[model samples]
Target: MYELRDKDFIFIFTGPNGAGRKTVAQMSGETLGMKQVISYTTRAPRSAEFNGQDYHFVSRDVFTEAERNNEFIEVIEIDGNRYGVKERDVAQMIEKHGAIYLVLNRFGAEALKKLYGNKAVRIFIYADLKTIVKREEDRGDTPELIQRYTSHYDEEMAYKDQCEHIFENLDLAHTVFDLTKTLDDNYLHRNLVDKD
Candidate 1:
């Protein structure tokens, strides 16, 4: 088993909806002992989502107030809902847990990369259109929601090349295995060079 000795970094997972980004992020975080940084959103939670586990669900007014106070590192609107990551929250998490993971869109990933530079590891997760559609359908997404997600598929895929790592998530186990290995390798390589 490969263990990550160094954890002063940020892992930003960005991908289109229904691509298994969240699952991969959660699994990899668990396997590697990294903390997952939850974001705040104004969107209502889905059937099985918990308040803080899935997201920091908040009202539009509250979110707006935080945004006006410049509390977020990055904020974006998707499907008529606002989502953001607070700067203070990230700092606090990193203070407690050396490394943290975040599930964000391509825009949010880009913003984080700018802020953290090389400390931000940008990873893009993707899947075939058919698989994405099937997964969303299985999750009970409405046709309109599916369409909204698929419409942005091309745009999201285009950003994959910009990421430092790209994973095509087909089989969950295989993808998670490969992801953990890649993360371990990257960590080792970076630490080895730092010692030189």
Candidate 2:
């Protein structure tokens, strides 16, 4: 197991579907020089998503086998597809980068927070239902998928208060700017405290 320092932050970004959580997390991580933690998923890749970059796409059998082996730190099933982060992968990233960000669902975020305590910073990025629907449609999501995601909007929203930060992602550029600024400030503060 990799030792965790107080200064090592695990940023967990989560929100309802089509809320732009992934994009915001990726952009903010890039700007802040934090490593992005790619999760393993049994779901098929989206049109623009790649096997390695976006997610380690795998078959259900493979995912089940990994789960049986206790390879995952946290796992959740959404829309009948399983997604999880490997424990070894997270330890490697933290060993290399000190800080890392992950785009996860509410369950996964909660699990990480429980494991890491305050070192886990949860950020909930969300938009209005109309905006979410529009974004999903623009992304060419099927009607069934769109409906399934939107139906869980309220449930996901209920988890917002459990997060450390909540942001309305109406504009991509502004959201990224705000997210990165907050992260940078926190990182600097943690380092300063560590030095003292």
Candidate 3:
């Protein structure tokens, strides 16, 4: 069992819809014993998604008010829906767990990185367009919505180079293993360098 020791990190997981970013973030959080940060969204919840569990579901008015109050670390509007990460949520998680994970859009991830500097690890999980389309369909997304989301695939792919780590989630087991191994290696390497 590889233990992370006293190392603390904030992982920002970002990918296009149906790329399994949330699922992977949750799995990684469980493996690492870190808390996953829930984002606020004005979009309606899908089947089986609970309020405050999957997302902090809110109305546009509330979301706008939050934005006006400067409560969000970052915010983005996608497909006419608003999504944001609150500063208080991240601060609470950091204070409690010393580590936190966020499933964020590119804008949110960029903002988090700018705010946290070396503490933020950007992980980009990706799959082929065909696989993404299939997964979106499997998740009960309408064809029209999937098409609209797919149109942004190129833009999402462009962010791959911006990430510190990239994982392909086609094989969940391998993906998880790769993430853990990378983290372990980085931690060990950092410790060794610090000792020297």
Candidate 4:
């Protein structure tokens, strides 16, 4: 286990797709004043997703070059589609916002932990498999893509115990409350240390 950081830093929420990670991140971001780091992905965008806003949609070749250059801190392939969080984007977010929030996969979260150690707070969010399938369908994921995702969903959820904290997003309000409480408890204790 790692001790909490001396200063405010990033909070990472990661899990399988449809685990309400992004939704909770956005909600907590509003409450905590943390900015998000938009990730880069080679996957084709959904109909409602906008490039840059949702993800920096890139070609495989371009993404490969960036990966080779170590431009991305973490990269993972999901069913032949590449997704990663760019180091530059994360740096920019941290520079602008004292503390940032991230919605990433297990690979990305682990990478961040290796990079930042205890400076990063890692939270794993998960839900029932049925809820996951329903959410994916509601999001318009193709049947094949959903199949690919569910195929390894258990593997993804297996990493929850590796995280610093885990939350089951069965209820949004409760998850949000618990997340905020975790943050507040840590932040408060850190502040008390500062006072001492």
Highest TM-score against the true fold, candidate: 2
**How would you encode candidate 3's per-residue C-alpha lDDT over 49-87 as one tens digit per residue?**
899889999999999999999999888998899999988
lDDT of each: 0.87, 0.88, 0.83, 0.81
Per-residue lDDT tens digits for candidate 4, residues 1-196, read: 2233355577899887778888898897877667888999999987777897778899999999999998888888877899998888777777666688888888888889898877787889899889999888998889886787778778888898999889999999889877877876775232212211
- TM agreement with the true structure for every prediction: 0.90, 0.92, 0.88, 0.85
User: Compared with the true structure, what per-residue lDDT tens digits does model 2 show for residues 11-56?
Assistant: 9999898899989988878777789889999999988899889999
- Candidate 2: give the clashing pairs: none
Q: Give the C-alpha miss distance for residue 8 in model 3, angstroms.
A: 3.2
Report residue 118 deviation for candidate 4 (angstroms): 0.3
The TM-score between candidate 3 and the true structure equals: 0.88
Ranking by lDDT: 2, 1, 3, 4
Question: Model 4 compared with the native: what TM-score?
Answer: 0.85
Candidate 2: which stretches are off by over 4 Å? 189-196
TM-score quality measure for candidate 2: 0.92
| Each model's Cα RMSD | 6.0, 4.0, 6.0, 5.1
Query: Once all C-alphas are superposed, what RMSD does model 2 give against the true structure?
Result: 4.0
